[model samples]
Target: MAELISLDRFVDVLQAARREHIALIGGGGKTTLLHALGSQLGGSRVLTTTTVMGHDQHGDLPVVFPTTDGDVARAARNRAVIVWRRIEGKKAKGVAREDCDRWFDLVDHVVVEADGARQRPFKAPAPYEPVVPATATLLVSVIGADALGRVIADQCHRPLRVAALAGCTPYERLSATHAASVLLHHRGALRAKPAGARLVVVINKVDDTSRRSVDELVDVLHGRDRALQVIAISRR
Candidate 1:
Protein backbone atom coordinates (compact mmCIF):
# COMPACT_ATOMS: atom_id res chain seq x y z
CA MET A 1 0.00 0.00 0.00
CA ALA A 2 1.11 3.55 -0.61
CA GLU A 3 2.18 5.69 2.31
CA LEU A 4 -0.15 8.47 3.45
CA ILE A 5 0.57 11.75 1.69
CA SER A 6 0.99 15.10 3.44
CA LEU A 7 -2.01 17.40 3.59
CA ASP A 8 -0.30 19.84 1.25
CA ARG A 9 0.21 17.07 -1.28
CA PHE A 10 -3.38 16.02 -0.77
CA VAL A 11 -4.49 19.54 -1.72
CA ASP A 12 -2.22 19.37 -4.73
CA VAL A 13 -3.80 16.08 -5.77
CA LEU A 14 -7.19 17.74 -5.58
CA GLN A 15 -5.95 20.47 -7.89
CA ALA A 16 -7.66 23.07 -5.76
CA ALA A 17 -6.86 26.41 -7.36
CA ARG A 18 -7.95 29.95 -6.64
CA ARG A 19 -11.51 31.01 -7.58
CA GLU A 20 -12.75 27.42 -7.30
CA HIS A 21 -15.58 26.14 -5.13
CA ILE A 22 -14.96 22.81 -3.41
CA ALA A 23 -17.79 20.79 -1.91
CA LEU A 24 -17.02 18.08 0.65
CA ILE A 25 -19.57 15.28 0.96
CA GLY A 26 -19.86 12.00 2.88
CA GLY A 27 -18.45 11.40 6.37
CA GLY A 28 -15.15 10.90 8.22
CA GLY A 29 -13.15 14.09 8.85
CA LYS A 30 -14.89 16.45 6.41
CA THR A 31 -14.42 19.31 8.87
CA THR A 32 -10.79 18.39 9.42
CA LEU A 33 -10.17 18.32 5.68
CA LEU A 34 -11.97 21.64 5.23
CA HIS A 35 -9.85 23.41 7.83
CA ALA A 36 -6.66 21.72 6.73
CA LEU A 37 -7.21 22.94 3.17
CA GLY A 38 -8.17 26.38 4.43
CA SER A 39 -4.97 26.55 6.47
CA GLN A 40 -2.87 25.37 3.54
CA LEU A 41 -4.45 27.59 0.88
CA GLY A 42 -4.33 30.68 3.15
CA GLY A 43 -4.87 34.10 1.48
CA SER A 44 -8.41 35.08 0.48
CA ARG A 45 -10.00 31.66 1.16
CA VAL A 46 -13.55 31.67 2.44
CA LEU A 47 -15.03 28.57 4.04
CA THR A 48 -18.60 29.09 2.80
CA THR A 49 -20.34 26.54 4.95
CA THR A 50 -23.48 24.73 3.70
CA THR A 51 -24.32 21.89 6.09
CA VAL A 52 -25.01 22.00 9.82
CA MET A 53 -21.69 22.25 11.66
CA GLY A 54 -20.53 22.71 15.23
CA HIS A 55 -19.84 26.20 16.59
CA ASP A 56 -16.17 25.43 17.28
CA GLN A 57 -15.56 23.73 13.92
CA HIS A 58 -13.69 26.74 12.57
CA GLY A 59 -11.20 26.78 15.48
CA ASP A 60 -9.79 30.35 15.69
CA LEU A 61 -10.79 31.52 12.20
CA PRO A 62 -12.83 34.69 12.21
CA VAL A 63 -16.46 33.91 11.38
CA VAL A 64 -18.72 36.32 9.56
CA PHE A 65 -22.45 36.07 9.06
CA PRO A 66 -22.75 38.24 6.01
CA THR A 67 -26.10 39.97 5.98
CA THR A 68 -24.92 42.30 3.21
CA ASP A 69 -22.41 42.30 0.37
CA GLY A 70 -20.20 44.73 2.27
CA ASP A 71 -19.82 42.27 5.14
CA VAL A 72 -18.78 39.52 2.73
CA ALA A 73 -16.29 41.83 1.03
CA ARG A 74 -14.85 42.72 4.42
CA ALA A 75 -14.46 39.06 5.49
CA ALA A 76 -12.81 38.17 2.17
CA ARG A 77 -9.85 40.45 2.97
CA ASN A 78 -8.66 38.05 5.69
CA ARG A 79 -6.34 35.16 4.90
CA ALA A 80 -8.99 32.66 6.03
CA VAL A 81 -12.55 33.25 7.18
CA ILE A 82 -15.70 31.21 7.87
CA VAL A 83 -18.91 32.45 6.26
CA TRP A 84 -22.14 31.17 7.62
CA ARG A 85 -25.68 32.39 8.34
CA ARG A 86 -25.97 32.02 12.13
CA ILE A 87 -25.22 29.81 15.11
CA GLU A 88 -28.26 28.08 16.60
CA GLY A 89 -27.37 26.78 20.04
CA LYS A 90 -24.26 24.66 19.50
CA LYS A 91 -24.66 24.18 15.73
CA ALA A 92 -23.76 26.65 12.99
CA LYS A 93 -26.23 26.88 10.13
CA GLY A 94 -24.84 27.49 6.68
CA VAL A 95 -26.17 29.92 4.11
CA ALA A 96 -28.25 28.75 1.15
CA ARG A 97 -26.57 27.62 -2.06
CA GLU A 98 -27.62 30.79 -3.85
CA ASP A 99 -25.96 32.86 -1.17
CA CYS A 100 -22.72 30.85 -1.48
CA ASP A 101 -22.37 32.09 -5.06
CA ARG A 102 -22.29 35.65 -3.78
CA TRP A 103 -19.02 34.99 -1.90
CA PHE A 104 -17.11 34.14 -5.09
CA ASP A 105 -16.80 37.81 -5.95
CA LEU A 106 -14.87 38.46 -2.74
CA VAL A 107 -12.87 35.28 -2.05
CA ASP A 108 -10.63 33.22 -4.26
CA HIS A 109 -11.40 29.81 -2.84
CA VAL A 110 -14.66 28.58 -1.29
CA VAL A 111 -14.87 25.34 0.68
CA VAL A 112 -18.33 24.04 1.48
CA GLU A 113 -19.24 21.14 3.76
CA ALA A 114 -22.20 19.83 1.74
CA ASP A 115 -23.37 17.03 4.01
CA GLY A 116 -23.68 16.01 7.66
CA ALA A 117 -22.67 12.63 9.11
CA ARG A 118 -23.15 13.09 12.83
CA GLN A 119 -19.48 12.18 13.52
CA ARG A 120 -19.87 8.79 11.87
CA PRO A 121 -17.13 7.24 9.75
CA PHE A 122 -19.32 6.45 6.75
CA LYS A 123 -22.74 7.45 5.42
CA ALA A 124 -25.24 7.31 2.56
CA PRO A 125 -26.86 10.61 1.72
CA ALA A 126 -30.56 10.94 2.25
CA PRO A 127 -32.94 12.18 -0.48
CA TYR A 128 -32.93 15.81 0.67
CA GLU A 129 -29.30 15.98 1.77
CA PRO A 130 -25.89 17.29 0.73
CA VAL A 131 -26.59 20.87 -0.32
CA VAL A 132 -23.78 21.05 -2.85
CA PRO A 133 -23.48 24.23 -4.88
CA ALA A 134 -23.94 23.77 -8.61
CA THR A 135 -20.89 25.93 -9.22
CA ALA A 136 -18.54 23.54 -7.41
CA THR A 137 -15.39 22.69 -9.32
CA LEU A 138 -14.31 19.90 -6.98
CA LEU A 139 -16.26 17.25 -5.10
CA VAL A 140 -14.59 15.16 -2.39
CA SER A 141 -16.30 12.06 -1.06
CA VAL A 142 -14.85 10.96 2.30
CA ILE A 143 -15.10 7.69 4.22
CA GLY A 144 -13.22 6.09 7.13
CA ALA A 145 -11.02 3.02 6.78
CA ASP A 146 -12.02 2.02 10.33
CA ALA A 147 -15.50 1.22 9.04
CA LEU A 148 -14.16 -2.07 7.73
CA GLY A 149 -15.10 -5.18 9.74
CA ARG A 150 -17.74 -3.21 11.64
CA VAL A 151 -21.47 -3.60 11.26
CA ILE A 152 -22.84 -1.00 8.87
CA ALA A 153 -25.52 0.06 11.35
CA ASP A 154 -23.00 0.61 14.11
CA GLN A 155 -20.54 2.83 12.27
CA CYS A 156 -22.44 4.37 9.36
CA HIS A 157 -24.92 7.20 9.18
CA ARG A 158 -28.05 6.36 7.13
CA PRO A 159 -27.23 2.70 7.55
CA LEU A 160 -30.43 1.57 5.89
CA ARG A 161 -29.59 3.55 2.78
CA VAL A 162 -26.10 2.10 2.81
CA ALA A 163 -27.52 -1.39 3.23
CA ALA A 164 -29.87 -0.87 0.32
CA LEU A 165 -27.09 0.28 -1.97
CA ALA A 166 -24.60 -2.35 -0.75
CA GLY A 167 -27.18 -5.15 -1.04
CA CYS A 168 -26.91 -6.19 2.60
CA THR A 169 -28.71 -5.85 5.91
CA PRO A 170 -27.73 -3.31 8.55
CA TYR A 171 -26.29 -6.01 10.87
CA GLU A 172 -23.98 -7.36 8.18
CA ARG A 173 -20.31 -6.52 8.31
CA LEU A 174 -19.13 -3.69 6.04
CA SER A 175 -16.81 -5.23 3.48
CA ALA A 176 -14.65 -3.46 0.91
CA THR A 177 -17.12 -4.40 -1.82
CA HIS A 178 -19.95 -2.89 0.18
CA ALA A 179 -17.94 0.26 0.80
CA ALA A 180 -17.19 0.51 -2.89
CA SER A 181 -20.83 0.10 -3.78
CA VAL A 182 -21.82 2.98 -1.56
CA LEU A 183 -19.16 5.29 -2.94
CA LEU A 184 -19.77 4.42 -6.56
CA HIS A 185 -23.53 4.59 -6.33
CA HIS A 186 -24.90 7.56 -8.27
CA ARG A 187 -27.22 8.71 -5.49
CA GLY A 188 -24.94 7.81 -2.60
CA ALA A 189 -22.05 10.01 -1.62
CA LEU A 190 -21.64 11.32 -5.15
CA ARG A 191 -25.10 12.80 -5.20
CA ALA A 192 -25.49 16.25 -6.73
CA LYS A 193 -21.97 16.07 -8.12
CA PRO A 194 -21.29 18.64 -10.84
CA ALA A 195 -20.77 17.33 -14.38
CA GLY A 196 -17.39 18.92 -15.09
CA ALA A 197 -16.02 18.86 -11.54
CA ARG A 198 -13.13 16.70 -10.39
CA LEU A 199 -14.18 13.81 -8.13
CA VAL A 200 -11.82 12.51 -5.42
CA VAL A 201 -12.39 9.94 -2.71
CA VAL A 202 -10.52 10.28 0.58
CA ILE A 203 -10.22 7.20 2.79
CA ASN A 204 -9.31 8.40 6.29
CA LYS A 205 -7.97 6.48 9.34
CA VAL A 206 -5.82 4.21 7.18
CA ASP A 207 -3.91 2.30 9.84
CA ASP A 208 -2.27 -1.14 9.43
CA THR A 209 -5.53 -2.89 10.17
CA SER A 210 -7.49 -0.88 7.61
CA ARG A 211 -4.86 -0.78 4.86
CA ARG A 212 -6.17 -3.84 3.09
CA SER A 213 -9.70 -2.52 3.20
CA VAL A 214 -8.57 0.80 1.81
CA ASP A 215 -6.67 -0.89 -1.02
CA GLU A 216 -9.61 -3.06 -1.91
CA LEU A 217 -11.92 -0.10 -1.87
CA VAL A 218 -9.55 1.85 -4.07
CA ASP A 219 -9.25 -1.03 -6.55
CA VAL A 220 -13.02 -1.27 -6.80
CA LEU A 221 -13.35 2.46 -7.27
CA HIS A 222 -10.75 2.54 -10.04
CA GLY A 223 -12.40 -0.36 -11.81
CA ARG A 224 -15.77 1.35 -11.77
CA ASP A 225 -14.75 4.99 -12.21
CA ARG A 226 -11.35 5.20 -13.86
CA ALA A 227 -11.23 8.98 -13.66
CA LEU A 228 -11.78 9.12 -9.90
CA GLN A 229 -8.72 9.58 -7.67
CA VAL A 230 -8.58 7.60 -4.43
CA ILE A 231 -6.40 8.79 -1.55
CA ALA A 232 -5.82 7.06 1.77
CA ILE A 233 -4.79 9.10 4.81
CA SER A 234 -4.67 9.06 8.60
CA ARG A 235 -6.14 12.40 9.58
CA ARG A 236 -5.65 11.69 13.31
Candidate 2:
Protein backbone atom coordinates (compact mmCIF):
# COMPACT_ATOMS: atom_id res chain seq x y z
CA MET A 1 0.00 0.00 0.00
CA ALA A 2 1.13 3.54 -0.66
CA GLU A 3 1.91 5.79 2.28
CA LEU A 4 -0.44 8.64 3.19
CA ILE A 5 1.18 11.86 4.35
CA SER A 6 -0.21 15.00 5.91
CA LEU A 7 -0.28 18.16 3.81
CA ASP A 8 2.37 19.71 6.06
CA ARG A 9 4.67 16.75 5.43
CA PHE A 10 3.90 17.04 1.75
CA VAL A 11 5.06 20.66 1.90
CA ASP A 12 8.24 19.48 3.59
CA VAL A 13 8.74 16.89 0.86
CA LEU A 14 8.68 19.67 -1.72
CA GLN A 15 11.63 21.30 0.11
CA ALA A 16 10.13 24.74 -0.45
CA ALA A 17 12.46 27.60 0.40
CA ARG A 18 11.54 30.75 2.21
CA ARG A 19 12.09 32.80 -0.93
CA GLU A 20 10.37 30.45 -3.35
CA HIS A 21 7.08 31.10 -5.10
CA ILE A 22 4.91 28.00 -5.28
CA ALA A 23 2.00 27.76 -7.70
CA LEU A 24 -0.82 25.24 -7.34
CA ILE A 25 -2.69 24.25 -10.48
CA GLY A 26 -5.22 21.66 -11.69
CA GLY A 27 -8.29 20.78 -9.60
CA GLY A 28 -9.71 19.15 -6.47
CA GLY A 29 -7.50 20.26 -3.57
CA LYS A 30 -5.67 23.38 -4.69
CA THR A 31 -7.29 25.73 -2.19
CA THR A 32 -7.02 23.20 0.61
CA LEU A 33 -3.38 22.68 -0.18
CA LEU A 34 -2.78 26.45 -0.24
CA HIS A 35 -4.36 26.89 3.19
CA ALA A 36 -2.49 23.92 4.61
CA LEU A 37 0.81 25.28 3.39
CA GLY A 38 -0.01 28.67 4.80
CA SER A 39 -0.86 27.18 8.18
CA GLN A 40 2.16 24.91 8.17
CA LEU A 41 4.56 27.67 7.31
CA GLY A 42 2.98 29.91 9.93
CA GLY A 43 4.10 33.51 9.84
CA SER A 44 5.85 35.27 6.93
CA ARG A 45 3.94 33.34 4.29
CA VAL A 46 1.87 35.28 1.76
CA LEU A 47 -1.20 33.73 0.13
CA THR A 48 -1.33 35.85 -2.96
CA THR A 49 -4.05 35.63 -5.56
CA THR A 50 -4.11 34.50 -9.12
CA THR A 51 -6.87 33.04 -11.24
CA VAL A 52 -10.33 33.27 -9.55
CA MET A 53 -10.86 32.02 -5.98
CA GLY A 54 -13.72 32.19 -3.48
CA HIS A 55 -14.02 35.60 -1.83
CA ASP A 56 -14.25 34.32 1.73
CA GLN A 57 -11.81 31.42 1.49
CA HIS A 58 -9.19 33.02 3.71
CA GLY A 59 -10.82 31.97 6.93
CA ASP A 60 -9.37 34.04 9.83
CA LEU A 61 -6.30 35.27 8.02
CA PRO A 62 -5.98 39.02 7.70
CA VAL A 63 -6.75 40.15 4.15
CA VAL A 64 -5.45 43.04 2.09
CA PHE A 65 -7.32 43.67 -1.12
CA PRO A 66 -6.12 46.21 -3.60
CA THR A 67 -2.94 45.58 -1.65
CA THR A 68 0.26 47.47 -2.04
CA ASP A 69 3.84 46.30 -1.62
CA GLY A 70 3.90 48.17 1.65
CA ASP A 71 0.79 46.34 2.79
CA VAL A 72 2.33 42.99 1.99
CA ALA A 73 5.57 43.94 3.70
CA ARG A 74 3.70 44.96 6.81
CA ALA A 75 1.28 42.00 7.06
CA ALA A 76 3.97 39.45 6.20
CA ARG A 77 6.22 40.68 8.95
CA ASN A 78 4.65 38.56 11.71
CA ARG A 79 1.90 36.44 10.14
CA ALA A 80 0.57 34.89 6.98
CA VAL A 81 -1.15 37.40 4.72
CA ILE A 82 -3.83 36.95 2.07
CA VAL A 83 -3.42 39.43 -0.75
CA TRP A 84 -5.80 40.17 -3.58
CA ARG A 85 -6.98 42.92 -5.91
CA ARG A 86 -10.62 43.08 -4.77
CA ILE A 87 -13.77 41.09 -4.33
CA GLU A 88 -16.08 40.67 -7.32
CA GLY A 89 -19.38 39.19 -6.23
CA LYS A 90 -18.58 35.74 -4.78
CA LYS A 91 -15.08 35.59 -6.22
CA ALA A 92 -11.85 37.17 -5.02
CA LYS A 93 -9.88 38.62 -7.89
CA GLY A 94 -6.13 38.12 -7.59
CA VAL A 95 -3.24 40.32 -8.49
CA ALA A 96 -1.20 39.77 -11.64
CA ARG A 97 1.81 37.42 -11.85
CA GLU A 98 3.94 40.52 -12.20
CA ASP A 99 2.49 41.87 -8.98
CA CYS A 100 3.26 38.62 -7.17
CA ASP A 101 6.84 38.75 -8.47
CA ARG A 102 7.33 42.19 -7.01
CA TRP A 103 6.77 40.85 -3.47
CA PHE A 104 8.84 37.67 -3.80
CA ASP A 105 11.52 39.26 -1.67
CA LEU A 106 9.09 40.56 0.97
CA VAL A 107 7.48 37.29 2.08
CA ASP A 108 8.84 33.96 3.22
CA HIS A 109 6.71 31.89 0.84
CA VAL A 110 4.27 33.07 -1.82
CA VAL A 111 1.67 30.43 -2.48
CA VAL A 112 -0.47 31.05 -5.54
CA GLU A 113 -3.60 29.12 -6.47
CA ALA A 114 -3.12 29.56 -10.17
CA ASP A 115 -6.14 27.69 -11.59
CA GLY A 116 -9.85 27.22 -11.02
CA ALA A 117 -11.73 23.96 -11.46
CA ARG A 118 -15.34 24.99 -10.60
CA GLN A 119 -15.07 22.56 -7.65
CA ARG A 120 -14.60 19.57 -9.95
CA PRO A 121 -12.39 16.58 -9.17
CA PHE A 122 -10.19 17.03 -12.22
CA LYS A 123 -9.60 19.45 -15.10
CA ALA A 124 -7.86 19.94 -18.40
CA PRO A 125 -6.58 23.37 -19.25
CA ALA A 126 -8.04 25.43 -22.05
CA PRO A 127 -5.79 27.63 -24.12
CA TYR A 128 -4.89 30.80 -22.21
CA GLU A 129 -5.68 29.09 -18.94
CA PRO A 130 -3.71 28.58 -15.69
CA VAL A 131 -2.22 31.93 -14.89
CA VAL A 132 1.07 30.79 -13.32
CA PRO A 133 3.64 33.26 -12.08
CA ALA A 134 6.79 33.57 -14.18
CA THR A 135 8.88 33.61 -10.98
CA ALA A 136 7.41 30.39 -9.58
CA THR A 137 10.03 28.05 -8.17
CA LEU A 138 7.74 25.06 -7.83
CA LEU A 139 4.56 24.02 -9.62
CA VAL A 140 2.22 21.41 -8.13
CA SER A 141 -0.36 19.87 -10.45
CA VAL A 142 -3.27 18.26 -8.59
CA ILE A 143 -6.05 15.83 -9.53
CA GLY A 144 -8.54 13.94 -7.43
CA ALA A 145 -8.29 10.14 -7.27
CA ASP A 146 -12.10 10.04 -7.16
CA ALA A 147 -12.01 11.10 -10.78
CA LEU A 148 -11.03 7.56 -11.75
CA GLY A 149 -13.85 5.24 -12.86
CA ARG A 150 -16.23 8.19 -13.34
CA VAL A 151 -17.47 9.39 -16.72
CA ILE A 152 -15.07 12.08 -17.96
CA ALA A 153 -17.87 14.49 -18.87
CA ASP A 154 -19.49 14.19 -15.45
CA GLN A 155 -16.41 14.24 -13.20
CA CYS A 156 -14.15 16.78 -14.80
CA HIS A 157 -13.97 20.48 -15.45
CA ARG A 158 -13.46 21.32 -19.12
CA PRO A 159 -14.58 17.83 -20.05
CA LEU A 160 -14.07 18.40 -23.76
CA ARG A 161 -10.54 19.57 -23.21
CA VAL A 162 -9.80 16.57 -21.00
CA ALA A 163 -11.27 14.24 -23.61
CA ALA A 164 -9.21 15.92 -26.31
CA LEU A 165 -6.04 15.58 -24.27
CA ALA A 166 -6.66 11.96 -23.33
CA GLY A 167 -7.80 10.98 -26.80
CA CYS A 168 -11.15 9.76 -25.58
CA THR A 169 -14.77 10.90 -25.88
CA PRO A 170 -16.31 12.88 -23.06
CA TYR A 171 -18.75 10.12 -22.18
CA GLU A 172 -15.99 7.51 -21.88
CA ARG A 173 -15.02 6.26 -18.45
CA LEU A 174 -11.81 7.79 -17.08
CA SER A 175 -8.99 5.29 -16.70
CA ALA A 176 -5.62 5.43 -15.03
CA THR A 177 -4.12 5.70 -18.48
CA HIS A 178 -6.32 8.65 -19.37
CA ALA A 179 -5.59 10.38 -16.07
CA ALA A 180 -1.85 9.90 -16.53
CA SER A 181 -2.02 11.17 -20.10
CA VAL A 182 -3.78 14.35 -19.04
CA LEU A 183 -1.28 15.13 -16.28
CA LEU A 184 1.81 14.53 -18.34
CA HIS A 185 0.68 16.02 -21.61
CA HIS A 186 2.53 19.19 -22.61
CA ARG A 187 -0.63 21.21 -23.02
CA GLY A 188 -2.49 19.50 -20.22
CA ALA A 189 -1.77 20.00 -16.52
CA LEU A 190 1.75 21.19 -17.13
CA ARG A 191 0.56 24.12 -19.18
CA ALA A 192 1.92 27.55 -18.26
CA LYS A 193 4.60 25.96 -16.08
CA PRO A 194 7.51 28.30 -15.46
CA ALA A 195 10.94 27.52 -16.83
CA GLY A 196 13.48 25.98 -14.39
CA ALA A 197 10.80 25.33 -11.78
CA ARG A 198 10.49 21.91 -10.20
CA LEU A 199 7.24 20.07 -11.03
CA VAL A 200 5.19 17.94 -8.64
CA VAL A 201 1.98 16.01 -9.34
CA VAL A 202 -0.43 15.48 -6.44
CA ILE A 203 -3.18 12.81 -6.49
CA ASN A 204 -5.60 13.84 -3.75
CA LYS A 205 -8.50 12.07 -1.99
CA VAL A 206 -6.79 8.68 -2.05
CA ASP A 207 -8.62 5.88 -0.26
CA ASP A 208 -9.19 2.15 -0.58
CA THR A 209 -11.46 2.62 -3.58
CA SER A 210 -9.17 5.03 -5.40
CA ARG A 211 -5.85 3.57 -4.18
CA ARG A 212 -5.35 1.17 -7.08
CA SER A 213 -6.16 3.82 -9.63
CA VAL A 214 -3.83 6.33 -7.97
CA ASP A 215 -1.02 3.80 -7.87
CA GLU A 216 -1.51 2.91 -11.52
CA LEU A 217 -1.49 6.59 -12.47
CA VAL A 218 1.67 7.21 -10.46
CA ASP A 219 3.43 4.18 -11.95
CA VAL A 220 2.56 5.28 -15.48
CA LEU A 221 3.65 8.85 -14.81
CA HIS A 222 6.99 7.79 -13.34
CA GLY A 223 7.58 5.28 -16.11
CA ARG A 224 7.01 7.99 -18.71
CA ASP A 225 8.99 10.74 -16.97
CA ARG A 226 11.28 9.86 -14.11
CA ALA A 227 11.82 13.53 -13.39
CA LEU A 228 8.22 13.98 -12.29
CA GLN A 229 7.58 13.36 -8.58
CA VAL A 230 4.09 12.01 -7.85
CA ILE A 231 2.51 12.07 -4.39
CA ALA A 232 -0.81 10.54 -3.34
CA ILE A 233 -2.75 11.79 -0.30
CA SER A 234 -6.15 11.97 1.33
CA ARG A 235 -6.54 15.72 1.57
CA ARG A 236 -9.37 15.94 4.11
Over the stretch 1-236, how does candidate 2's per-residue lDDT look in tens digits?
45666666877776676567889999878888888788777448889668878888986788886446877878788678788888899988888988888787777788999888999989998898889989899899999888998999999999999999999999998998998899989999777888889899988888888888888887788889987888788755
Candidate 1 lDDT, 84-145, residue by residue in tens: 89999999998888776667666778889999999999999999988988888888999988
Q: Report residue 60 deviation for candidate 2 (angstroms).
A: 1.4
Model 1, total clashes: 0
RMSD of model 1 against the true structure: 1.5
Model 2 steric clash pairs: none
**Candidate 1 at residue 208, lDDT?**
77
What is the alpha-carbon lDDT of model 2 when measured against the actual structure?
0.84
Candidate 2 at 123: error in angstroms? Answer: 0.5
Q: Model 2: how far is 184 from its true place, Å?
A: 1.0
